[model samples]
Target: MTTRTRTTTVTWSQANARRLDRQSLGGSGSPALGVTEAVAAMLGAHAQVLSAAELAVGVRAPGVTRAEVRSALWTDRSLVKTFGPRGTVHLLPAAELPMWTGALSAVPGEAARLPGDARMTPEQVEAVVTAVAEALTGAELTVDELSDEVIARTGPWAGDPVMPAFQGMWPRWRQALHLAGHRGVLRYAPNRGRKATYTNPGTVPLPGPQATHALVRRYLHAYGPATPAHFARWLGAPRGWAGQLFEGLAAAGAIEEVTFEGVGAAWVAAGDTAFPRSGPRGVRLLPYFDAFAIASMPRDRLFPGAAGDRALAGGQAGNFPVLLVDGTVAGVWHQRRSGKRIAVTVEPLAALGGGRVRELERRVARLGEVLEGTAELTVGAVTVGGHA
Candidate 1:
C-alpha cells in the first residue's frame, strides 16, 4: 500500500508575514545586514533605476548609505551590475555570479519577434557573443566603441543597422547583449562622464549540473509557497519548462507541495514549511521595481481590493512605488526631490488609525534618511505617473 504525502496549508496573512521576516523587512531593530548581504537576501535588487536600487538596499539594511552601496559595487567589487531576473538590470552579489549565470543561461530562449532581416541566426549570435567577450576583456568600452570593435572582429553582418530602438536603429549584434551578460562574458563598468561602459568580468567557472535546482530552492526560500508558473513569470522563463523543472525537483525530494489557503497547490523548499502566527504589523515605503513587490506570488492577495487597480500597472508589479501596511499594499506614494529636501505624497485607500499614522510618519522620515535628504510627508493623492 502507498501512503499519500501530507500537505500543510498556510493562510495569505501568515505567508506574507513569513516572507517579510525572511526578506528582513519585518520591522525596526532587524539585523544591520551589509550591502552585499542585503542584495543577496533579496536575490537581487532591480537596478534599471539606480536610485531605486540604492533605496531598496538602504531600507533593508537599516543604516546603510547610498555611498556604501556604490562602494560595494565599484570600490570593493562585492556587487556586480548585470542583467538578472526577467532580463532586467540588477545589482547581484559578485560571488554568486557563477550560479546566476548558469541558471540564466539554462533558461530556454524565446524566439525573437523581430523582422526577419533584423534577427541573427544561431551561428551569428554565437560569433557576436564571442566577439563581445574578446572586445571587452581587460578594458571598458562605451557602446559605440564596443560596437566598432565587435563589427571589426565579427564582420559587417554584425553591424547591420536594422533593429529598431527608441528613435533609431541598433546593430544586429547588439541583440546578443543580455545573453552575453547571462553567460558571464560581460558586465557594466563605471560610467565615463554621462556615457555607460561595459567590461569583461574575467573567467567565470561553469555552474555545476545542480545550479538551476539551487536557484529554484533559493527562490522558494524567499518567496514560497509558489507555483512553477509563478517562478516562470518571475524568471521570465517558459511556464511549461518551469513546471517540468519543478516536477524533477519534487521527484528528487528537494521540494514539497503544500496547499495555500485561497490559492491552490504550491511548492516550498523541502522542510521550509513553518510560518509566523500573525502577519506583519508596520508601514513601509517601497521604491519602484522593488524585488519583494515583483517576486511575491498570488498577486491579487498582495495587491488586494483597490490596490490591484492602483499599485500594479496593467497587471504588472513594481511599476509604481507602493505603501505597505501589514505586509500588503495599502496605498501608493511618490517622492520629489528639490535640493536637500524630498516631498513625499501618499494616497491611502483607506483611513489609518492613530498608531499606523504615526508609523507612516516615521517610515517617511526613515525614507528621507536613506535618501540623505530631509523628507516631508503630505497625505494626499500621488499624481506622479508610474516610474516617474
Candidate 2:
C-alpha cells in the first residue's frame, strides 16, 4: 500500500494543494493559464463555448460562451465533466474526455477486458452506437427506453429487447451514450429529465485517452494542492491500472510529483499562477463546483468545517452557488430567472460590510451576463450585518 505523508504548515500549503488531484471543470489545472487560454486548449484549440445557467463552478462556468464545451460534451462524448476528484461532476475539458471515459469503460466486469457475443462484439457495438445515434437525431430518451429501443431494432449486432440478457447493463448502456457523445451526437436535456436523457451528437468522432491524460494533467496543475489518489477517484479509473499508466507517464517525464508535508503526488507545475488569498481581502463568491470548492476532496483542511462537519455538504449536489468570506462558506446564493430578469439573493450566515456587498453585486452582474439576462443581486446581513 502506498503510504501517506502529512505536513501541516502555512508556507507549504499552496504548493501542497498542487500535489493533489485536479478538477477539469472550468479552466486548465495550471494557474499559469488564464481562463481564455485554458478554454481554448480544452475545446480542441478552437471551439465554441455555451451560455448556460448555474452550471457547476469551475467545471461548468455559466459564463462560458463557447459552444464546443457545452453542446459537444452531451452530443459527442456522452460524458459530462465533473469534480469526482471529490465526487462532483466538475467541468471536464474536451480534449481529456476520452481517457476519463475509456478508463470507465474497462472498470466493470472482467468480461469488459475480453470480447463477448456478437451483440456485444466490436462490430455489434458500433452498430448499436450507430442505431442509437440515428434514433436520437433530434430527440431525447432515458437509458431504459433508449437501450430497449436499440436492443429491439435488429440492426447490427442484435439482442432481445426484454430478455434477462439486457438486465444490469448500465455501463453498456452508458457506452452507447459515450459513443454518441464522442460523436457530438447527444446532449442532456436542461435540468435533466426524470432520468438522464440525451440529445443528438451533431457530427464528429470523439476524443480518446491520449487526449484525456493531457487534459487532466493541466487541470491538476491549476487546481493543485491535490493528490494522485484524488485523481484516481476523479477519473473513475481502476487504481491498479491508473497507477501503472500514470507511473509510465511520469517515468517518461510526462508528469512530476509535488512534495510537501513529507508526502508527494504526481503533478504538473502551474508556474507563476496564484489563487486569490484570504487576508484583508476575506471573501470570494464561488460558483457551485467552483475549483476552490472541490479543489480538495477532504475540504476541512481549507474550509470552515475542517474538523467538525462529518458529512461533506458542499459539492455538485448538496451545495449551490456560495459566498465565501475569508476562505470559508459564509453564505449561500439563490438565483432565479423570470424571462429576461435574473434575481440573485444571498443568504449570509454572518455579517458583511458595504464594500463587500457592492463587490458581490458586480460579481452577480457578470453571472447575469453568462446566464443571459438582467439581474438584481441582494446580500443579506450576517450577525454583524443582519440575518436571512
Top-scoring candidate (TM-score): 1
lDDT of candidate model 2 versus the reference = 0.47
Please provide TM-scores, in order, for all candidate models, with all chains considered together: 0.97, 0.58
Q: Which candidate is the best by lDDT?
A: 1
* Error in Å for residue 24 of model 1: 1.0
Relative to the true structure, candidate 1 reaches a TM of 0.97
lDDT of 2 by residue, 243-322 (tens): 66567666776665554333344354333234323222334555543444544444544445521232135322223456
Q: In candidate 2, what residue range of length 10 has the lowest lDDT sum?
A: 44-53
Model 1, position 24, has a per-residue lDDT of 81
Tens digits of per-residue lDDT for model 1 on 155-267? 99999998889879998898899989999999999999999899999747456447789999999998999999999999999999899999999999999999998778999
Off by over 4 Å in 1: 28-31, 203-205
